[model samples]
Target: MAHEGKADEQLFQLLANLLHQVESLTNQEEVELRTKIEALGLEVTKVPSKSLKQLDELEIAKELDKLSEKLDNVDEMISSAMAADPQVQSLLSDTADIWMPVITASADERRNFTPSVGENSETEANCES
Candidate 1:
């Protein structure tokens, strides 16, 4: 009935909102990571060309590796959020699966009962008097 449809709409809206939130979080993380990488690149570019010692360069590279690991963690978190978000959608999907057929059959029955304007309405009016 109307109630079930309303419930479905609410569920769909909730799931959609959650998905959008996760997407926004991912975008924010990407922007933040890009900024970090650009800043690090600028810093590395400032290093003196004369003192190109392997050990110092390796240490700087290790710092970049740490940043990379942090990015990986952010990615994992986003993946986890996405994975969990599906549970809400799955429930809504289940509701649709069980109720959609019944709603369709009821709608069909209602359509069948509706009289066409020309013949049936006139016949029914004649019978009523």
Candidate 2:
């Protein structure tokens, strides 16, 4: 039982690290998306072409879907980490209070900007028991 507890601790730490990485990657992707949008906006303002502009819009939509998937994975990691310990569950609850709205807003903003976008197909699966 003692060894099992130690293993659980290690697992929790691993989950935390993984969640942090996912958060970082998601943030980086958001920045990249914003940059692409700005660049495309500039192009549209300067030399607006339907084909190029439409392709850029499609790319942005795809990137947004990818971002949504990444955020879902981060949420799943947090949920799994919290399940490992009561303390972690409480901590995650607090963190979610701060983070969940921002992630949801980000997704909503993307959808609002791109009305002709496709829905995301990323589903979170539980692998840890």
Q: Per-residue lDDT tens digits of candidate 1, residues 23-127? A: 464554345534543554454335457755556878989978996897687467646644766753453354453334433455444334422367435533432
Encode model 2's per-residue lDDT on 42-114: one tens digit a residue: 4323533466444587898997898679668656755775685565565445444333433345433423432
Candidate 2 whole-model C-alpha lDDT, 0 to 1 = 0.44
| Residue ranges of candidate 2 with Cα displaced over 4 Å | 1-55, 95-129
* Candidate with the greatest lDDT versus the true structure: 1
Per-prediction TM-score to the true structure, in the order listed: 0.27, 0.34
lDDT accuracy of residue 120 in candidate 2: 13
